[model samples]
Target chain A: MVHLSGIKAQNLTEKGVKTRMKILETAEQLIGEKGYYETSIAEITVKANIAQGTFYIYFSSKKAVFDELVYQLSSDFRYHIKIAMEKEDTFEAKQRAGFLAFFEWVTKHRNLYSIVQQAVVVDEKLYRAYYQKIAAGFITSIGKAMEAGECKSLNVETVAYCFMGVGQFIGMRWVVWRDQLVPNDVFEEAMEILFNGLTHKGGKKNWRISRTGYTNEQ
Target chain B: MVHLSGIKAQNLTEKGVKTRMKILETAEQLIGEKGYYETSIAEITVKANIAQGTFYIYFSSKKAVFDELVYQLSSDFRYHIKIAMEKEDTFEAKQRAGFLAFFEWVTKHRNLYSIVQQAVVVDEKLYRAYYQKIAAGFITSIGKAMEAGECKSLNVETVAYCFMGVGQFIGMRWVVWRDQLVPNDVFEEAMEILFNGLTHKGGKKNWRISRTGYTNEQ
Candidate 1:
């Protein structure tokens, strides 16, 4: 279900690979900024510094290029996250690392949010595929944690989607909207909610009481 | 920042209001299905069985109608959630009710996911406003819970976004994709994860072990 490589870049010369990369990058920027419907193939070709016919050599149509861009971006981020997760020993630590990797990748490709959201309108199937692939990865790692008794035995698919939602919304609020790295405090608070749940468990001090001047009765 | 009523909807006669609603409803169905750019005003009017000039009575442009549709949908769901939350006494129960209200609302307005997503491209500010309005409501409710010590004392905004993410992804996974209500077990599992955290504490039996035939050592 996952295609790890570009659409037509296989068996290409070094120059052909570069040209293909150029086209994909250009499409990413234009489509990311102007949107799919508003962006024209001519604009992509001009921005890519390639002839119109050259685009056809790499992709059959505008939608084809857009699909490849989504695929490449998904693969790139997942690879980075997988590498980051490998450096951690425990499931919680690995999950945290994976999230950090996602934020870092999104910081570099800020257009990722825009492009993926645009897919909802441009191609609904592609949009679903993008998240389904991410959820699949999460389900696998979370399933392992459950087997090890390191995590709760909730439905694997449900947990996977929940985790994806956290990563996406947190990234959207801090990185995408503010154009800044998620502050450490915000990240820790999110982790706290995910790990400890929102119910006050009595042992820990109330963090917001000191930080936000909220009075706690107990 | 929240506009409870529709744009330019004030002081209209009963017949005027009905005509206006017809335009918004038609716009929602078409935009939800074909997307914003692909769906034309002419098509909306045709489907609505109204004259082309009649659309101008309610909206100035296609974008105007789209903005109103977003506003109307946001208002509709928030109103329903507010009523649902009011019926509950505790913060946790209120939140659970809110999620239920949102899910029920989305079941009827399935195009909501697509239309709001399209706002990411059609009008970024409107898209942001949509979630921000929803977040504002969440923050107010969550803040009260934190103050009363019913919830953890983490950053209010962080908690708000996390809750929003959970609602959105869970809804998208079940209601939007599958075109069915979120199943009872799935709903209960989500509530458990939200209320109790995902770490398996010592007492409760592992639910998935029995359901999936996986043996748990502990």
Candidate 2:
């Protein structure tokens, strides 16, 4: 519901913050690789090379770590997207940069889709909040684009989800499933669909043109 | 990956088939509600009012039932979409009907997203194949649409995934997350974006039209 208030902002000594971050990074990798149910506090400590008791100083429980990880990942995701978009000059370009940044970030994290999706079963509220937060980012940026007349007047919520869907699935298909970068042509083609749609500029009236490029009578 | 060879087609008496179906339906609900790792075979049989050993007769293990459920859900999904699309007369209409049918089906099988997504962690291969099978269906349908000039010439695979993503995130946003049907207006707006894109039809040349709707100097 709120902008992902990631883990209670813990005030800690520099060393303490580093150790906490180490624990979080280790948990992210382990949970992403092995799953939340399978990963335990003991394992996270072991993997982080810290004592089991040390984990409690940071996170209260394994579920707490998972929640914090989701929040952290969500925060990191939006931050990266915002940074990428800021470098672009146009709304369309910003979107392209955002998509590119998303693919890049997910490629590095690799466990993002798996870990975040697990929230659906692991914690329903967290699952919803995670996406709602991300969609909020989309809604704001998109609403501005519409107001600036950079886009159409279609419902912004609908547009936001559609935008999110395009990014999510394309990243899932190439970056996650295939373990490959989204090739330039593939990315461009998808952009074309987003910008111009499946209807060719010339064949605007027909939704079904023939194999030989003829618009058959409907 | 091979086509989803959904649960080995077993020859059984009519009563046996019905009992098997009952187990599957029960498993779908249980897994969707409680998640795969938490739900046990004993719990499943108990909930279904069957002997624990009887579940083994229908499925070799908990994983087997999960796999079969994924297969069954995918098969049922495609069948329904095919039927709904067939009833429509044009490619666009067929896509609209297909999306509508998909929303309706997922609404009924509310666990479809959760169960299928869990496949990522439960069985990565099954998870990938489930989506691949669905994407294959999209590719074939969208390919035909493109060939017939019903749609544009964007890369079919990219187009297929884009199509898949839109349906997925939109469904997740309204149906899965909100626990409600996708509103008619929202659905229509999404359709408009798909066919016409985020760019206004008349303002196609403007990437940054002013608040006054003027396609101003860049």
Candidate 3:
């Protein structure tokens, strides 16, 4: 396989890099509006103010541009996740905080999130790549927490998948197809239940306090 | 539009119903052995010991039978869910029971589950029909629960979508692409976390301990 990272290093100058970002950003926005199948390279070129051939020069096809857009978005998603994890104190708080940060980023990059969501169900290569790229990091974080006796000691992969299952659902429901925002606290509360359990375990621990700063009653 | 349900209503002969069931069963088995795209009307007819003309007489085209199959599957899924809910004691238990039952059925019917999952993501009209059909019932349930004050009042549409979203990712991760079976308890635990959340002062109250008698704590 021709490595894309290598191609980017060789083919792109700083100017080319800027153009590529613009193209990807534009493609992401258009895909959000028209979906993956409806959006075309011509529209992307027109929107990016570049030649159709130039679009090809940077990426092989519309799918390639899409893959790259997801690649960039996921990396950025990880960066933001890391940032939140660092800022928080405990591992549990970090997981919750990182998820909230990731959710917020997805809210901002609604377009990218929609495109990736569609890709997960639509294409085989995209589905496998998405799973490979996103799942490992998630499993590792949860695994580390389990190992350190911070989180529940369940099978890490299953728990990781459980978290992802819930996260993707939230992104689709609250971010893409909805009219209003689901409050951040609501999301945090949900995460608390997911990671912790719903009952009053006598640990006023590991959950978001409601808007009134009152923890939910048993 | 031509209606298969109408034909079923019209058929009074014992032979007619038996033949119809035979054809459907053969088609279902063949679909598992061979994929939807690869399985043809001719092959299905031959396998069922029916004539080619008879096949078309039963269903209009390839797409129609596929649609009917999925429609039936969706109906069955909803039926199982209703049964689960009706049997459960508490509201939270009802949701958990319903979800576990649904997921368990999907697990048992892996090939059928995959066929339906692919229909939603790969085919446009099929996807819409599948989504809308399932969404309608879920919307009603959420609306009822919200009105009854059984749960937190939230946007019914977004909440329904969110619920489906969780199912989608988990289905793909654990059921479709999964190399090994992720056990029922893992999914049960996930659902518990999803329904009640960890941060609530009432810790275990939101969860319905499964028939397995294990807490999803691990």
Candidate 4:
């Protein structure tokens, strides 16, 4: 058994990167289905059709691949957002578009999203990496909107963090935890509540982007 | 030991519900320091200076005590909020006072808050019970406010759930995750933003009281 395992490890190393990708993809799907703690290295290797010993050659531990997966997933999310933004012109559209797209993506891939969440509680390394990737794109765009005078200029970083926190909080509350979302119109209502706020009286005499990207009061 | 445990369980049940409260209190303080997972029945017994058998008399499992502790803590939270409102007459003052008292209480004893957060990720029983306690007082207040026309006629339950999620998320992000927070003013700023929101012109808005006890918004 040991000799066969050794040969399998060498074959995996010879196969190179695809072996690693296969392991990661297998881990992602497995963790998504059975959770991180429940799924073992042996399970991942068997599912990936690699030898048990071959798993450690590509990644250090269960946690490392989880971190890499989150990083890659976040990158994909940001790429999608960038592509979506490029497809639209105005800043307002981008803001609304960003949230709508995020909500849809998260809902459609609920399993993956839950895996990221489960990773957070299971390990500390995954938690930090998770938070970093969790809302970085949304945070960056909020800063850009401030610079472009599309949104109010306050502490851009704080607003970004606040929005990310609130958005996820609402998503977790509605979709993940309770599932009482108002069908298709939830995001529209959310965006309306978020952008216009509960108090905004449409577009007149309310706060808007300035040429200087900041209000005169400051 | 089994005989002693059985006798103790019988004695505890034979007496009244007061023993349960004592066990929960010690569990709360210990679990706060040791955390939910790290905490055990032995630790609680040691802290309470009770026998290991006595610990099992009131609680079934370590998780059971943790869940019950959360329920009791939120009950105390609501009771405190009720008391704070009694001291303050204005709707604005009452709301701010309620949140202020809440922040102070939660920040002072973040261990319990951390445990509740752990429940969000770990245990299902603790999760639902935690949110239920959270929803109760918040929903009641929102319902009262709406009936009095102090705010929009929105779903109080949804708003309550959202507020609970948002408040806990920020508290976890700022207090638990960050090792340090500068200037107490940030919390005040946070509360202001939460209530009045960023859309409102900057600068602190002091909470004001209405002439009547009910409300005046629609």
Instruction: Choose the strongest candidate by lDDT.
Output: 1
The residue-by-residue lDDT of candidate 1 on B1-218, one tens digit each, is 22337445577877888888888888889999888989999999999999999889878999999998998899989998998788768888788778888887888899999999888888989988999999999999999999998888889999999999989999999999999877766776676666667775444332221221111112
Instruction: Rank the candidate models, highest TM-score first.
Output: 1, 2, 4, 3
- Looking at candidate 1 chain A, the ten consecutive residues that score lowest on lDDT are A208-217
Ranking by lDDT: 1, 2, 3, 4
Give the distance in Å from residue A138's predicted Cα in candidate 1 to where it truly belongs.
Answer: 0.6
Model 1 docking category: acceptable
Error of 3 at B56 (Å): 10
Ranking by DockQ: 2, 1, 3, 4
lDDT of 3 by residue, B1-218 (tens): 11134456475466765566666666666654454555788988998899998877668876677777776667677787898677655555566556655666666566564456445333546755777788898788768776777656655665565567667667666665763344556665555455544232333322221111111111
Which scores higher on TM-score, 1 or 4?
1
Error of 4 at A71 (Å): 3.2
TM-score of chain B of each: 0.88, 0.87, 0.75, 0.68
i-RMS for every candidate: 9.7, 6.9, 11.9, 11.4
| Residue clash pairs of candidate 1 | none
Question: Per-model C-alpha lDDT, please?
Answer: 0.82, 0.80, 0.62, 0.57
Task: List candidate 2 segments past 4 Å from native.
Answer: A1-10, A202-218, B1-10, B202-218
Cα deviation of B175 in candidate 4 (Å)? 2.4
B-chain TM-score of model 4:
0.68
